[model samples]
Target chain A: MKNVKKVLAIALASVMAFATVACGNEGTPAVGTESGKTAAAGTWRIGGIGPTTGGAAVYGQAVQNGAQIAVDEINAAGGINGVMIEYTFEDDENIAEKGVNAYNSLKDWGMQMLLGTVTTTPCIAVSAEAAADNMFLLTPSGSSTDILEGKTNAFQVCFTDPNQGQGSAQYIGENNMASKVAVIYDSSNAYSQGIYEKFAQEAKNYSFEIVSAEAFTADSNTDFSVQLQKAKDAGAELLFLPIYCEQSALILTQANAMGYKPTIFSCDGMDGILTLDNFDVALAEGVILLTPFVADATDDATVSFVTKYQAAYGEIPNQFAADAYDGVYIIKAAIEAANATPDMSVSDLCDALKEAMVNITVDGLTGTGMTWEATGEVSKDPKAMVIKDGVYVGY
Target chain B: MKLRNKFKFDKRARQSLITYAMVIIAFVVVQILLATGSMTSLMKGLLVPLCVYAILAVSLNLTVGILGELSLGHAGFMCIGAFTGAFFSKCVQDVITIGWLRISIAIILGSAMAGLFGFLIGMPVLRLKGDYLAIVTLGFGEIIKTVVNVVYIGRDENGFHFSIKSNMDLNMTENGKTIVKGAQGITGTPKDATFTIGIILLLVTLFIVLNLINSRDGRAIMAIRDNRIAAESVGINITKYKLMAFSISAALAGSAGVLYAHNLNTLTASTNNFGYNMSINILVFVVLGGIGNIRGSIIGAVILTLLPELLRSFNLDNLRMLIYAIILIVVMLFNSAPSFIQFREKVTAVVKSKLPKKGGVN
Candidate 1:
C-alpha cells in the first residue's frame, strides 16, 4: 500500500509536467490581435497555415515547401526591396477549430499575407478568422465555391467547386454517357458533397437517372456491398464515387469483390489512383476522374514544373501539389507587385493582387491559365482523365 | 452529533466554491471580450460546444468514476437529444416570431427530448454490470451514428453540393432538391448560441448536478456505487436512482448538443452526431481532470480544448500527437505514487528542519 501510494505520487507529479509540455507554447499569446509588432531586428515575416501532421500532412508539407522555395527564389532575386522574408508555418491539422486557432496565431504574429492549405473546412475557418482580423489570405488548393462565395478578403489559387462539377457533367453529357448513375460520397466532407452534388445536378440536366445516391461516413465501414446492392438494384450502369482517394480505393476493391463492377467516375481524389499498390488497375478499369492537371497532359510551364517537382520530390506530382506550388508563386508575384508600388497598403496590395488574378491568365504548371470569378475561385475547368493500365492519361 | 459537527466542512463544498470562482472568472473575461468586440462571433461559436463537452464529461464521470459503470454510448443519448431538440427548434422557428419565446421553447423542448430518450435507454442498460455495459453502450453509439447516416426523412438541398475532392456541384434541378442537404451537410441552422446563453445554461446544469449530488438520491446512488449489495440491503431503489441520474445527465448533454447545432449553423450527420472518438476524448478529459470532481472535469475540458492551440505556439508546427504522447509519458512517470509522496515528505522535512522548535516539542 505504501509503495502504491509512492507510485501514485510520482505519477501525479509527472502528469503535471506532461500537461505543461503538452500545452507547451500556448503559455502567453492567448489573446491575439492584428496590429503589427516591431521586430527585434526587422526580419520580414510570412504566415503559413496547413496540416503539418495529419492524414493530409503529406500534401500540406509539400505546399509549405513550395512556398519556401518561392520565397527563397524571390530573396535570391535581390530580396523584395532588400528585406529578407521569414516564414512562420501554422499547423491547422485540417480541423476547423484548430484552423481558427492557427489563423489567430498568425494574426498575432502580425502577418501581412498568408498562403497554403488545400482543404475547404480549414479554409473556411481560417478565412473567417482572417477576415475578422483584416489580413490578406490566399489558399492553394481549397476548391469549395462556398468559401469565397461572398467573402472579398480571401482569394483561392485553385479552381472553384462549381467549375469542377460543371466540367464533369459536360464531359459525360457530351460523350453521350451511361444513363443510370450511382454515387458513393463521404457524408462528412464538403469536398465530396461538392462533387457529388454537381454530378447529380448535371446528370439530371442531361436526363440521366440517379439509381443510387448512398452516403457513407469517413472510413466507417470497409465494404461497399450494401451501397453497391442499392446501385445494382437501381440498375446503375455508371458508378460515380467522388470520395477521398484512400476510401475511393477501398470502395473500388470492395466493389470488385462484390462482383458488381460499374464504370467508376471520380474527381480529383483519383489523381493518385495510379500510385495505389494495394489495389490493382483492374479494379479502377474504365474509371474517369476530374482533376486540375495530369503530369503528362500539359507542356509549356507545366512540363518544367512537373520536371522540377519530380526532380525535387522524386515522384510524379499530383494536381494538389502542383496547384499548391502555383499558389506560392502567385503570392510571391503579389508581394513583388506590392513592393513595386512604394506606397502600397496591405489592402491596396490585396486589390492589386485581385486585379492581377482577374486580368492575367498564365498557362500554369497545374493546368491552364487561371480564369477567376469575382468570388475568388480560379476557373480551371476540371479535366477528365482515365486510368489506362496504371497511368493517368487524359481522355 | 457533536463529533460530526466538529469536522463537517465538506471537501465537496470547498471544491464547489473553487469551481464557481473559476466559472465566474471565465465569464468575466468572456464578457469583457464580447463588450470590446474582440472575441465577437467566436464566443458564440465555441461556447455551446465547450459547455456541451463539459456537461458530457461531468455526467459521464458519474457513471464511469462514481457509479463505477463504464458506459460509452453517452453520445448516443446526445445524438438522440440533438435530433429531438432540432425537431423542436425547427417547429418553434417555423411558427413563433418572438425571439425569447423561441429560445425558451427550444431549450425546454431540447432538455425534455433528451430526458425522454435517456430514461428509455437507461432503464434496460442500467441492469448490466461492468465491461458488458461499456461494450453495449459503445455499440449503441455506433448504431445511433449508422441510423443518422442511413435514414433520411427529407432532402433539403439549398441548390449546392460541397465536396472535398472536386468543387461545389450546383444542382439547379428541382426534384433532387434536399432539405438536410444529404451528404453535403445541413446548413442555415439558426444561430442562437450566445456566450451569455451558454454560461447561463452551464450555471443551470452545474446547479442541478450539485444539488442532485448533495440530495438523498445522489447519496443513495453513491451508496450503491460503494457497495451495491449493502445499498440494496438498506432498501435503496437502485434502479430508480440510476435511471434518474442517467436521464438528467442525458438532458444536460442534449441541451449542449442543441446549442452546438445552432451555434455552428450547420449540421453534418457524418461528423456532428457520429464517432466514438468524441465520446472517448470527453471521457479522457474527465479522467485526466479527476473523475467525480466537477471542478476537475471543467478544468479538464478547458485544458484539453486549449492544449493543441497552446502547443502550436511552440514552433513544433505539426508534432501535436508527438507532444501529446510525450506529455502522457511524463505525467505517467511523475505520477508514480511513491516518488511523489517521498518528494512531499522530503520537502516537509527540509522545511521542518529549517524552523526552530515550537514549545520544545521537537
Candidate 2:
C-alpha cells in the first residue's frame, strides 16, 4: 500500500507538471502578435470557435483556414483601419457545453467579436450567451435559422436552410427537371430537417408529385438500402437528399449498388460530396445542388479567391470555407462602416458592430449584394451546379 | 465501554456522510469562486454540466458498479427525460412563468417517464447477462434516438397531434405550433437550470443512492452480483432486485437528463445528447472513478468534464484528447493496481507517524 501511495503521488505530480507545461505554451504567443507589424492603435481581438478535433473537425479546419487567410490578407494590406486583427481559435469539439466554455474563455480573453462556431449545433449553443453579453457572433457555416432566430447579436454568413431548400425546389420546377420527387433526409440533424421540411413545403407550390419520403436518424446504420429501394419503387425521377457530405456519399453508394439511378437534387449540405475518398464520381454525375459559392465561377473575384485559397491550403475551398472567408470580410466591413475606434469599449464596439451588420451589404466571394435580414439571416443568391467528371459546373 | 462504543463510527454511514460533505464543500468552493469573480466564465458555464455529469456517473455506478451489470443504454433514459421535460416545459411556458417551479414539476414528470421506460425495457432485458445485455441496451439507446427523431408532436386549434411520417401529416391548424419537430428537436426550452439547482439535484441523487446502497435491497443486489446462483439459493429473487436497481438507476439518470435539457435553450437527439457516445462517456466516468465508489464517480465526472476545457486554455487543441487519454489511463491504474495500493498505504503510514495523535478527545 505504501508503494502504491508513492506511485500514485508521483503520477499525480507528473500530470500536474504536464498541465503546467501545456499552459505555459499558451502564453508564448500572446494575443495581438499575429502580424509582425506592431499595432499603432489597439488591436481588434477576435475569437474563432469551432470543432477542431472531433467528427466535424474537417469543417472546423476549413473554417479556421479561411478565417486565418482573410486575417493574413487584411493584415498584409495595412491592417483593418491601421489596427491589426488578433485572432484566437478555440476548439469546441462539436459539443454545446464545450462551445459555451470556448465562448466564455474567448470572452474572458477580451475578444471584441467572434468569427465562427462552424457547425449548426455549437453555433446555436454559443449564440444564447452571445446575445446576453451583447457580443457579436458571425458564424460562417451555421446555416440553421434556429441559430439566428430572435438573437440580435448573432449573424450567419451562409444562406439559411429554408433559402437553400426553397431555392432547390424553384430550380427544379423552373428547369423542369422532375415531375416526381422522393426525399431522404436525416431527421436527427437540424440542418437536414430544416432543409427537408422547406423542400416539402415548396414542392407543393412546384406542383411536383411527392412519391416517397423516408427519414433516418444519425444513429441509424449506414445501410440506406431500405430507403433507397422505397424511392426506386416509387419511380422517383429525382431524389432530394438534404444531408451532409459523408451521409450523402454513403447513400449514393448504396443507391448505386442497388442499381437505383435517380437524378439527385440536394442542398448546401451536400457541398463536399465529391471530395470523399472511394466515392465513385460516376454516381454523383449529374447531381445538382444549390451552393452559395462555386470554385469554378469565371468571375475575377471568384477566380482570385479560389486561386489564393488553393495556394494557401492546397485544396479547393468548399462552400463552408467560402462562407467563413466571407465572414471575416463582413466583420471588417462592419467595423469600418460603424467607424469603430480603439477608444470604444468592447461592449460599445460590439453594439456598434451589431447595428452595422444589420445595415451593411457585403460583396464577398460567396455572393454579391449579401445583406442581413431582421431575423439575423443572410440573404444571398445561390448558384445551381451539377457534378460532371468529378467537378462542379454551373447547370 | 459504552462511551467508547458511542464514539465508534459505523463505517458505511461514515463513508456516506463523507460523500455528502465532499459535495457540499465542492459546491461551497465553486460558489465562493463565482462570487469573488475568480472563476472564469468558462468554468462557471461548466458548473451546471458538472452537476449533471456527476448525477449521471453516480446513477450509472448504481447499475454498472454495485449491481455488476453492463447496461449501456443509460443515455436512452436521459433522452426520454430530456424530451419529456423539454416538452412539458414548452407546454407550460406561459402557464407557469416561474422558472424554478416549472422545472421542478418537469423534473418529476421527466423522471417518472424515464422510470416507466426503464421498467418496460428492464422487464425482458434483465433476463440477459453480460455482453448480450450490453448489446441490447445499446440497441435500445439507438432506437430511442431514432424514434424521437421520427416522432413529431404539434398543437393546433383542434388539439395535439402525433405523426411519424412528417410534420405535414400532423394536419394542424394555421395557429399550430410544433412542440417536437422530429429531428429538428425541442427548441425554445425554458433555460432555468442554474448551478444552485443542479447542485441541489445532485445532492438529492447522492442522498437516494447512498441510502439505497446501505439498504437491505442494496445488499441483496450486491449479493446477486457476487454469486447469482448462491443468491438464488438463499431465496433472493434475482429478477426483482435487478429490476429495482435498474429502474432506480434509470430514474436518476432521467433526472440528470432533465437538468441537462433545461440548461440548454435547444435540445436535440444528437450524439452529443442521447447517443451511444454519451452513454459510453457516462460509463467512462463510472469506471475511471473507481467503480462502486459514489464520491469517486463525482470526482471523476467533475475532473474529466473540466479537463478538456482546461486543456483548451493551454492551446493544446490537437493534443488535448491525447493528454486526456494519458491522464485517464494513469488515474485508472493508480485506482486499481495492487502495487499502487501498496505504495499509497506506505505513504499514509509515514504521514500518520509524522502527525501528532489525538488523546483525550476520544
Candidate 3:
C-alpha cells in the first residue's frame, strides 16, 4: 500500500510538471507578442515547413534558403507595406504526420502565411488542415493535382505532374528525338508513378511508341539491370527516368556498367542529380529534362537570383529553390494587392490573400507570366534543360 | 480468517485496475486540456497518432514480451489493415453516410483480413524460431508493401475488378471510382477519425490484450514460452497457443491501422508510414518500456511520440532522432541497471519515511 501510494504520487507530480511545462511554452509566444519584445506591432509572421532532414533534405534545405533570401531582400527593401516580415522555419522530415504537426506548431506561434511543404505527401497532408483552419499555404514545389482538389487557399508554384509529363512528351515528339521510347520509374513513389502514368498516356497521342516500361521498388539496393536490359533489348532510343537525384545517380551508374548508353530524359526531380557527391558527372552528360528554372538562363531576373543564391549558399540553386524564392514574392504581391493589415485575423487575411492571389501575376525567377488560377492551379512554362560540361544548361 | 480472505484483493486484478485507471486518467486529462484550448494544435494533432502508437506498442508487446517471440512484421499487419480498411470505406462511402458506422465496419473487416494474413503467415513462419522467425517476418513486411504497390482495384457498373497492371486494365466505367491506384494508393479516404474514437479503440485494445494476458489460455501460452517441453508433457498444445496469441496481436494491430487510415486524407504504402522503420519503432517502444510490462508500454508510446514533436519546436530538428535515441537509452538504463534500482529504492524509502503512514502496513 505504501509503495503504491508513493508511485501514484510520483506519477501525479510528473504529470503536473509536464502540464506546467507545456502551458509555459504555449503562453510564451502570446506573451512575447503582447510584450512586443521581438516583433513590432505591425509585423507579419510567415512560417516555412519542409523536410530538412530526410531523403528530400536537399529540396527542403533549398526551399528554406531560398525563402530566407527572399525575406531578407524584402525586409531590406523596407518590407511589405511598411510591415516587417518575421520568418520561422520548421522541419517536417517528409512525413505527412510531421508536416501536420509543423503546421499546427506554426499556427500556435501566430503565423499568418505559410511558404512551405517542399514535397508532395507532406504538402497534401498539410493542405487539409490548412483549409480547415483557413490558413494561406503556398507550396513552392508540391506538384500533385490531388492536393488542389477542394482546397481553396492551398496553392503551388510548381507545375502539376500531368502538366510536366505531357509537356515532356510533347517536347520529345516535337524535337523528333526518338520514335521509340522507354520508361523506367520507381513504382513505390507517388510522384514517379503519377508522372509515368500521365507520360505514358500522352506519349500515345504524340505518335511515340512506348516500347518498354519497367519499374523497381524504392529500396536502396535496387538494381536496374533487368529493366535496363529489357529496354535495351526493345530498341528504345530514349529512356524516360522519373525518379529523384539519388536513384537517378544509381541508375546512371548501373546503365554505364551495362555499357548501354541512351538519351536520358526526366522531369524536374532530376534537377540536382549532377551535384550529388561521388556521382559520375560524365554519365549525366547530355541528359535532358524539363524544369521551370534554369541556373544558366540569360534573363536578368534569373541571373541575378542565381547569383544571389550562389553567394548565399556557395552553390547554384536548384529548381526547388527558385520556386520557393518566387513563392515568397508571389505572397508579397498578394498581400500588397489585397491591402491586408496585420491587425486582421488570420482567417480574414487568408480570404483576402486568396482572392488577390487568383487575380494577380508575378514574373519570378523561374519563369515570366506566372499566374495562379481560381482553382489554385499555377501556370508557368518550363524550360528544356540538358547537362553539358558537368552543369545544367538551357537547351 | 474468512473475513481477511474476503477483503484481500487479487494481485492480478489490482494491477489490471491500476493500468485501466492510469489510461483513463491520462485520456481525461488530455481531453480536458484540449477542450479548454490549453494544448497547442500540434499537441492536439498528436492525440490520434498517440493512440495509434499506443495500440501498436501494446499489441507488439504481446508477441515480443509475453509470447517470447521476436516478430518484426507488426507494421505489415498494420499495412494490410490500412489498405483494406481504406478500400472498404471508399467503396461504401457513398452508401454509408454515418461516419461511425462506416468506420466500425471498416475496423472489423480490417482486423479480420489482418488475422487471416497472420494465420497464413504464422503457419509456416512460426515454425522457425529466433533469428529465422525475425528474418522471415521482415521479408513478409517487404513483400506486403511490394504487393500492394502493384495491386489495382476498381468498381464499375459491371462489378468489382482487380488487376495487378494498371487501373485501366480494371475495365471500369466512367462513373466507376478507382479504389486502389497501384502505387498512388487510396486517396480521399473519409476523414472520420476523431480523438474520442481513437481513445475508445485504444481502450478496446487494452481490454482485449489485458484480459487475454490474465486468462487461462494466457497462462498456458506463457507456460509454453517458459518451458515448451514441460508444457507439452502437461498436455499443452504449443502451436495452438502460439497461433492464438499471434493472431490476436495481429488483429489488435489491424485495429490500430483502422484508426490510422481514417485519420489521414491519403494512405500510401510508403516507408515512413507502414514500413520496416515503423515495425522497428514499435519494437523499440516495447523493449525500452520493459518487456511484458503493459503500463510501461503505454508510457513509452506516449513519451516517444511526443518527444520528436517537442524537439522540433525547440529548433533541434537536426538532432531530433538523436535526442530521442538518447532518451530511450537513458530510460532503459534506469529501468534495468542494478545501480539505478538501488538508487530508486533508496529514494522510495526516503519518500515513504517523509510522509505519514496510512492505515496498517502490508
Candidate 4:
C-alpha cells in the first residue's frame, strides 16, 4: 500500500510537470525566419479572394480559374520582369466575416497584393481590412457604386452600374417613347438595390417618370401577379426588373402569363439570358441590359482568354466567370508591375502597387481601356447587351 | 499494523487541493501564450471549441455516467447562452467605456442567463427520464431556431427605427431598434476573446466538476447511475440531483457559448439548433475520451479539432473526409483494453533509442 501511494504521488507529479511544460511551450513566439520574399526569392506571390463555396461558389470558381489562366499565360511569356508570378487563393465563402479571416490568414502567409472579393459584402469587408493592413486590393465584379464612394486603397476594374444606369437612361430618353416605368427589385440584395437606386435617380435626369417602385423579398417571393397587375393598370410601358437571373426569369414568365408585356430594362446580371422549361423566349425578347463581357464577343485578348478557358473548362464561360477571370489578371498586372519579390514586406509591395494602379490603363479582355480615377474607380466603358431571339448579343 | 493503516492508499480518494493548484498553474501558462498573441490561428480557432466541448462532455458525463439519463439538445442551451451573452455584451459595449470589463461581465451574465434557461427547460424534461427527454430538448432547439428566423428583424436606422419591408423606403432611427438581427445573424461583435481566457474558463469548469465528483453528492449521483431504484429507495433525491446536473451542464454550455460568440465575433441562430448530429458529436468526444474523465475529454477535443486541419495540406479535399473516417475507426477499435500499455511502451522505447544510455560519463 505504501509503495502504491508513493507511485501514485510520483505519477501525479510527473503529470503536473508535463502539463506545465506543454502549456509553457504554447506561449512562446513562432520563430521569425526570413520573410516570404527572401525565403522564396525572385517570385511574385499575388493573392486571390473569392467564395470558393456557398451561394456564390460558381462566381468564386470562375475568378479562381481566370487568375490561374492569366498566371499560366504570364509565366509562358517568359514571366514578368524575369520573375515568375504565383497565386494563392482564399475561399471567403461569400461571407464578410470569413473574408476578414481569410485576409488575415493570407497576410500571415506573406501575400503581397490581393484580388478583391466576388460578393459585395466580402468585397467591402476585405477592401476595408486591406486598407487597415495597408495592402492593395482590386476587384473585377463587385460594382456597387457605393464601394467607389470613399475607398482609397482598393480599386475597382469594373465600371459602376450607375454608369450603366446613366447609359440605360440615355437610351430610354433617346427612344422618346415611354414616360412611366415601374421598377421591381430585391432590397436585401446589395447588387439589385444598388443598381435600382442608381436607375431610379438617373431616370429623373431623363424625365422618365417612375410610376411605382416596390421591393420584394428574394427567396420567399412567389406571387408577383399582384405587383404586375398594379403596374399594368398604371399603364407602365417600360418595366425595369433589376433582379437575379433565376428570379428575373420567373418574374418575366409570371408577367407574360398575366398578359402584362412591357419593354424590360435590367442591370448587368440580367444579360445571363437564362431559360427554364416554363420560360418562353418571346417573353424575354428585346430585354436590354448592360454587361462587361459576352462569351462570343470577340477581342484579341478576350478571344484568347475565352479560347484558353474553353480549352481547360470545355464549356462557354458566363459573364460573371469572365469578369472573375479579368479580376485575377488585374491583380497579376499590379503584382508584375510592382515587381514584388517574396522578401519584401506586404506593405512595401502594396506601396509599389498603389503607384502601379493609379491612373493605370490597360487594354483588357473587355476590349476597352480600363483606367482608375482618383478614387480608384475604373473607367471601363460598359457595353449594353440586348436579348435577340433568346440570345444575348453585344450592341 | 497502525503504521500500515496510516500509509494505506485510498482507492476512492477525494480531489486534493494540490490538483486545483496544478490546474491553476497550467491555466496561467496558457493565458500567457494567448494574451501575447503567439498562438497560431489554427490554435486560436481550436481553443474555444476545445474548451466548449470539454465543458459539455464532462457535464454530460454527469447525465450519462452519473444520473444514467441520456439527454440530447445540449447545443440548444449553448445557443441560448450565446444570444443572451451577445445581447448583454452589445448593450455593455454601447453603455460602458472599458473593453476588458465588458467582456468579463458579459461572460458571467451570459452563463447565468443560460443557467436560467436550462432550469426552465430541464425541469419538466428531466421528469420524463429517457428518450422522451431527448425528444423534448431536440424540439426546444428547433423551436428556438425557427423563432429567430420568423421574428421581424429590427435595425437601427439613422434616427427613425422601424422594420422596412422594402429598400425604397427605410426610415432611420436610434431608439427602440431591433436588438437581435435574427436570421441574417448578429454582426459587429467585439473580438475580445483569447486562448488564455478560454483555457482559464475550461480549467475553472474542470475544477468545479472535479470538486463536485469528489463530494458525497457525487457518490450518490454515481449510485443512481449504477442502480436508480436502489438509490431512490435509500432516500436519494433523484429528481433534485438530476436537475442540478442538468443545470450545471447548461451553465457550462452557456459559458462556452459566451466564449465562442466573443471569440468569433459573429452569431447565427442556426448555430444553436440542438441537432442530433451535434449531440452525437459531443457524446462521441466524451465517450472517446473515457466518460467522466476530464483529461480524456480534453484529449478527445484536441484530437478531433486537429485531425481535420492535418488533413488540409494533402490538397485532397475529397480524400480528407475518408482519412478522418479511417482515423476515427482506428481510434475506436483501440479504445478498449491494453492499447495504452502498448502505446506507452512504444513511446518509451523510441525515446530511449533517441537518447544515449544516460551516463556515458561525458
Model 4, position B296: C-alpha lDDT score:
59
lDDT of 1 by residue, A233-260 (tens): 8999888877777778888887787788
User: lDDT per residue, candidate 3, B246-357, as tens digits?
Assistant: 9999988988898898988878887778889999999988886669988778877877787777776666777888998897788777766888777777887776786655
Report the TM-score for the A-chain of model 2.
Answer: 0.90
Best by TM-score: 3
Arranged by TM-score with the best first, the candidates are: 3, 2, 1, 4
Q: Is the docking of candidate 3 incorrect, acceptable, medium or high quality?
A: medium
DockQ of each: 0.27, 0.41, 0.49, 0.10
TM-score for predicted model 3 compared with the true structure: 0.94
For each prediction in turn, the share of the native Cα contacts (below 8 Å between chains A and B) that it retains comes to 0.21, 0.58, 0.48, 0.03
lDDT of 1 at A287: 83
Better of 2 and 3 by DockQ: 3
lDDT of 2 at B190: 79
Q: Encode model 4's per-residue lDDT on A97-131: one tens digit a residue.
A: 45665665555445667776777756765676577
iRMSD in angstroms, per model:
6.7, 4.3, 3.0, 7.8
lDDT of 2 by residue, A288-365 (tens): 888877778888878877888899888887887888889889999999999897556556877898788879999998
Instruction: Score candidate 1 by DockQ.
Output: 0.27
